[model samples]
Target: MKDIIILMFRLMVCIFEIWMLFGFYNNFLKNKPRKSRNNIFIILVFALIIFAINSIDNTILNLICVPVVYFVLAIVAFNGNVFKKLFGTLIGTIVILGTELIIVAVLNITSKELIESSMVNEPSAFVLTIIVKMVTFIVFEIIKQFSSKESEMMDGKTFCLYILTPLSCLGIMFSVVFCRIDFTENSLAKSVLIIFFFCMLIGNAAIFYGYNRYAKILVEKEKNRRTVMEQKMELESYKKVNVANDRYITLLHDTNHHIKTVYSLLKKDKKDDAMNMLSKLFDKYEKAEMIEYSGNTILNTILSDYKEKSSKENIECDIFVERGFNIEYVDEIDLVAMLSNLLSNSYEAAAKSDMKKIRIQMFMQNDGSFSVIKIENSYTSMIVEEDSVLKTTKQNKEFHGLGIKSVQQIAEKYNGWLSSTWSDNVFKSVLILENSMC
Candidate 1:
């Protein structure tokens, strides 16, 4: 009966540890509930393994086994980057183990014999286990309150910096707990030392929580900066379109003078020159004229502006648009801003490439459920990518990199998405927007 009771207590501790691990994960990683049965089963199998490992009472084996098992659990059952999941597991392990160590250290300070006997007594061990687990639970709750649900990528330096505090604190904890120092004779000093260790444990959690808050503030500031820049670009685009409109109106007012010059050349018996003059007039007219690229006026204006810029840069531009297709669901300013960013990037890329060509294709899908905008530009330079997204190769990276991100944000606003790929000296970007027309 005593053996059964001990086994039950062990099982209870195992279950509690698992619960605490899950709570730690919830602060950072998400469970893969889509495959609920598989996840639960995998966790159960690992729990049993952990329970068996704990029963062996081998310190070295348990240390090696727990982290390995949790790493596996993270990979199979958690939804996050592998590194983040592992980090979460490591933090959980440290908190639980550190709490146990400090509690034991404190118990030893009060009575060394009590600490030693707790190892052999099931009830004493049970009480100690409950104390450690309860403290761990409180620490986990404190962390969860400050944990950001949004998964932000941490750079290597920042990750190292944030993790250093907890690691150093854990080391200090180990040294304080395991060092050859007897505090049994000094009650006041022991009490103070015990309070200090507890504070250190909580302080480790506070460091990560502070990191989360700091990261969130940086993210929000970046978002605000991008918003401001995009709005400024939108206003600039609108101004340029207005300038183009005014220029076209001036060209229209000069039509009579152009016609008379061509007629005068013909009358002067210079047939070839007259033909050349007429050709120049037609070219000028075509340059200023806005081709009906799509049923959307904002799209047409943006395309016309970029097309003119492409001509000035000596970049070949080919644009094909299906007539009568429109995206009225998107706001005018957003549509203009998105297309401007995409075309601007394409123009810059094509201008620097060997081929110097840009092609744009816009059409409604067969099912009339979506509209597609595809931009392809040739490039000879190297493409820098991070996390599968293109990084800007321009010197002014601060402003340049936000172009693709802004395009993506605007696309997503209208139930749309953007994808880009580069190969064979050509880079292609495709934007898909749900068609409200149907």
Candidate 2:
């Protein structure tokens, strides 16, 4: 019964160690924390196979088993890049095995006879083994966490940490081996307790370091997001001011022409014709001023700006927009960025074509759950390549390639969707965004 218990304890310790190592590799090394359930099951099976191998005494079997397990783990880490995966797993396994050997050596030097005796069916000895393995696992996990964050830095701090952390673990193990402790009358339980406490101290230190680094990363990312938001707001304000100024200037200039036309008609004594012409011109001018919509001012400005540019290039522009869209679902800046990229691309494409025509349609659904925007233009050739990027032509290299990628990024940021296709010599792009207003 005592022998059975010892075997069971060893099995459990091995399984736990494997679990921690594989979990760390999957999370920190692969940078994929959210794997499927199938992957977890596969790792567990592999760990069990490794644990079972200790029962086998055949040297050939042990040699083959170790490499196979490491190979499987490497495949998981390197996403099936056999050479890199094998190399990394081999290095990691060597470090782990080396640390274990050092631990055994230290215990031997400190209390050779006592350690050998303690290994014989003592529950306390098994507990000490568990404590050591757990502590080592935690230390390695901490190193992995810190190393991941450090990798993002411009400097080589993370790389230095990675190199130093494993070395430090090795040094600690060696120190414990070299320092002899006279365990003359100390109970195995008491000795195990002391080692457990020391291991806990090391684990705690690692936890502190990992948390501090993780928190710093969070703070930096938050600051960057805020700065981006501020810049976007400033750009939107500038666009509004420019649009308002241009509208005012255009109105002032048109008023003088209106007055001159009225005066000439009256002098010709064609009073009825002059009144009719004045009424039509006044209605047309008023309609021009009524383009702005309150709910989505940024989108309105973008459309208006593109419309003016298209008119200058002699590209016929057709736009139909439904009023009173719910702006609650998207920030003004993101909305502006999305529309600006899409419309600018359309205008540029249309300008390059022989037909030179573009059509834009935007509307909010009746359910108020989504907003749809579509832009289509006549093109001399297909716009997108097989990879779904705008194909560049010698005449329009500057603006042809980036529009689709920009729109896709904006859509992803807002939890929206974008798709484009070409058919019948016409290019069409469609965007759908969840209406946060609902």
Candidate 3:
């Protein structure tokens, strides 16, 4: 009966651990967390296998089977490249093994004392495991609910902490197990194990505290930057509106002056000169005083600023945008930086080109699902391509291409990407941002 209770307790712990391990990933992904309908079925099936293993357990066999449970849970729950899933399982297994070592070592010390006092039984050990697993489940639930889910997966090296910390715990366990040559005397070995456990706890606490604090600081900085950019965009938007109003008041006078000049040239029968004057007027007067670009005032502000800048630099910028599009969900700073870099590059290239023109195309489509921007420009000098990348002509190659890289990073934040190509002496960049409508 005691053995049966032990198996049931093991089954319960295994089920709880499975839930804790697999459910952890959902907290870190960008999408809303979802529980698979088949998750319960999978857990129950594995719990039976765990119970069977516990009933006829050999230490070696149990060690092997335990990791199988975690691996299965990871494979079922994780959505990623094979390496991510495999390494994720490896981290989970290392933590579990390290934790089990501490549990077993503590259990041995306590069980020996209880045995001496005639209070020890198989059921007592099972009860101890139940208490431990229950406490662990609570901890996992608290961490999952309270801790901030990662905005994105940690870089491979940072995630290695999940491996290194547990491996350190395992190393300490091995030192305690092998060096003393004594297993049971309530000796210095137990003290060492207890200290190692506390040390790991402190280490984990420090990591969590430091990492979360740093992440919070970064997020705050990003928000502040965006807030500043939003204000700047608003100010620019107001300036454009005011300047456009002024231009509206002067447009009639300017048209009257052009018409008088052209009419005089025609009266003199200088038809060619009249036509040249008319063409110049056409070039300068094409844009209306007030043109609606997009509903996103921030975007409109950027487009207007750069359009004026390009005109001043004698670069022709052709902009196209869809009506009634929404980009309120995007971070203003990121959007600004992306467009700023793109236009900066286009201006530089067009300044050096014979054509001296930049073609800009922006549109919203896919039922409010995406906003796309395409910029194409001509480069007169050799593109300086190496390894399929358009190398910068600036002497400081180190900093030359960072603008594009930064723009790419911004695009990635929106679940989109930036791609650039240089072909037939024409350089083009395409940025796609996923729109968040719902």
The best candidate by lDDT is 1
| Higher-lDDT candidate of 1 and 2 | 1
Greater-TM-score candidate between 1 and 3: 1
- Per-candidate clash tally: 0, 2, 0
Q: Is candidate 2 or candidate 3 better by TM-score?
A: 3
Q: What is the lDDT of residue 149 in candidate 3?
A: 53
Assess candidate 2 and give its lDDT: 0.64
With a 3 Å backbone cut-off (N, CA, C), the pairs that clash in candidate 3 are: none
Highest-TM-score candidate: 1
- The digit string of per-residue lDDT tens for model 3 on 1-438 reads 646645555675666666556555445433224665666777677767766776685889988887777666666655556565666566666655665676667757744554443213443343344334433443443445444454433445665655465455545543433343332555345435444454564455455446646866876776565556545644655677677666666777798888998999999999999999988777665563344587775577667777877788888888888665567788766666788778888888888998888888887767778888899998888766676656777999754675776677678889888888887778899998998764
Question: Which runs of model 2 end up more than 4 angstroms from their true locations?
Answer: 1-237, 249-295, 382-402
Q: In candidate 2, how many Å is residue 345 off?
A: 0.8
Task: Compose the digit string of candidate 2's lDDT tens values, residues 1-438.
Answer: 757856766666666656556655544355344456856666667767877886776767876787678767656543534565666567557656655666566665676564555333354455346446644664665555555544233234544564455456545543443443334466654456545544554454465447546866976775465446546744965666576668668877887887788889899998998899889777666545535744555666667767767877999999887776566577766666677667767777789888898999877775878888989998875543654455655467553454556567668766788998877768899998877667
lDDT of model 1 at position 437: 63
lDDT of each prediction vs. the true structure? 0.75, 0.64, 0.65
Q: Give the TM-score of candidate 1.
A: 0.61
lDDT of 3: 0.65
